[model samples]
Target: MQAVTFQAPGEVRVEERPEPDLLARDDAIVNVDATGVCGSDLHIYHGRVAIEPGFTLGHEFVGTVVAAGDGVTQVTEGDRVLGCYCSACGNCFFCRRGDFHQCDDGRVFGHGKTLGSLQGAQAERVLVPHANLTLRRVPEEMSDDAALFAGDVMGTGWHAVDQAGVRAGEAVAVLGLGPVGLCAVQAAKAAGAATIVGIDSVEDRLEAAEAFGARPVHLMEDEPRAAVKDATDGRGVDAGIDAVGHPDALELACRLTRKAGTVAAIGVYAERVQIHMGVVWIKALTLKSGQANVIGHVDRVLAMMAGGLLDPTPLVTHHMRLADAPEAYAVYDRREALKIVMTP
Candidate 1:
């Protein structure tokens, strides 16, 4: 098997690797049909995340099961499935509370040893742990490109909206226009948000958000606060989502949300960043920030996709072969692609 591995900061290589085999009764081996280059992958690519050299470096994947242990009953060999970005023990403390994202023994695929030493799915074949909790069958009508998002990006987007408790006809402002940001727009729309403001500086992304039924506001050229207010009748949005994970973006999301509203920071943040507490205190805001609970939301997300309410096909900007991962990373780093799907 050939896997995309991290060589160093700003470098990745597709190297020949050993085939993965089941090591646990609940484990399964998947023949990866398509894998995604996600924004989270970019964190490792930029050396922000410490991953060992030769560590497989992808998480979002759609594939067919080649083999499964006797304990794996939800899916069997020959099933087309999508693997969640992280695996969780179904009986753990957090899992029992329906908080699988905080499972004590959780492992994120493609992230290195610190995250459970689980090798990634960006290869021809990969091992999957906790198969029942981590893998879900892809709908027969769902395309590979669309199914892949259910495990990660689209799931995160749904989480942002869900965590914020966006109600029907409520207003939301998604502060970023990347793949996740755009997906957030769609999710908000599906949730019946009457007004959506998408803030980003990139022209293409802004356009993409508009196509998804959001009022696009340029981060630089356009006044996001003013635009949001105009869209909300001078009141800020019911919820604000900070999808950029930057300090400035977080602050802006807080500022854009109405008083006593919620702010969901769904983007990846590893370091301590400062935000104005006085503003939050004055507004009596409810702040929620962390990794998305994709495991908890995958079924609902897939159902939405199958019902045609959520479509990520337009987000698939590039498709390349597994062997060309080096160039793929470069293209993603250059912001030349939104969601890059690679086939083995």
Candidate 2:
């Protein structure tokens, strides 16, 4: 099998590797059909998130189940499947409470030994741990391209809106317009937000957000704070989402949310960074931040995707063969593509 491997900072390669087999009673092996190149992959590509050399490197995947262990009951061999980026042991304390993202035995695929030594799906095959909890069958009507987002990007986007408690007739602001941010815009609108503000610097992303029913605001050219205030009649939006992992976007989200409103940081924050506690304290804001519970939200996200209430098809800007993964990674790292789907 040919898999994408992480070499070092600014490097990735497509190399022949051994195929995976079911190693646990709850495991399932998937014949990967399509896998996404995500922003997280970029972190490892840039050496920002350290991983061992030659480790398989991708998480978002849509494929067919080639085999399943006896313990896997939710799905079976021959079923079309999509895998969550991470898996959780259903018997854990957090899993018992529906907080599967925090399950005591959670393991993330393709993140090297630190995350779980699990090989990624950006290849001919992948091993899905806790199969019953990690893999969801893709509806027959959903395309491989569309179903690909259910496990990760779209799930994370929906988590932002869910965490913010977006309600009908409420105003919401989503900072950043990457694939996650664009998906956040759609999620906010689908969640019944009357006004959705999307902030980004790129013109194409701003245009795309507008097409998704958001009032796109250029982060540098336009004053996001003023725009949010004006849209809310002087008060800030009811909820603000930080879709960009940068600290500046997080700060802006906090500032754009009204008093007693919620600020949901759906972006990745791995290290300690300075935050303005005074702003949060003075405004009486409810701040929530962490990795998205993508496993927990996959079902709902899939439902929305199947219902056409949330379509991320447009975000698929590039479709390339798995053999071209090195170029795909380069394009993605260069910020030239929104979402790249690699077919094995």
Q: Give the TM-scores of the predictions, in the order they appear.
A: 0.99, 0.99
Model-by-model lDDT, in order? 0.95, 0.93
Candidate 1's C-alpha runs over 4 A off are: none
Give the per-residue Cα lDDT of candidate 1 at 265. Answer: 97
Backbone clash pairs for candidate 1 read none
- Clashes per candidate (backbone, < 3 Å): 0, 0
- What's the CA error at residue 269 for candidate 1, in Å? 1.2
Q: State the weakest 10-residue window (summed lDDT) of model 2.
A: 266-275
Per-residue lDDT of model 2, residues 204-279, tens digit only: 9999999999998999899998999889999999999999878899889989999999999988998888779999
Collision count of model 1:
0
Tens digit of per-residue lDDT, candidate 1, span 140-203:
9999999999999999999999999999999999999899999999999999999999999999
Using alpha carbons, what is the TM-score of model 2? 0.99
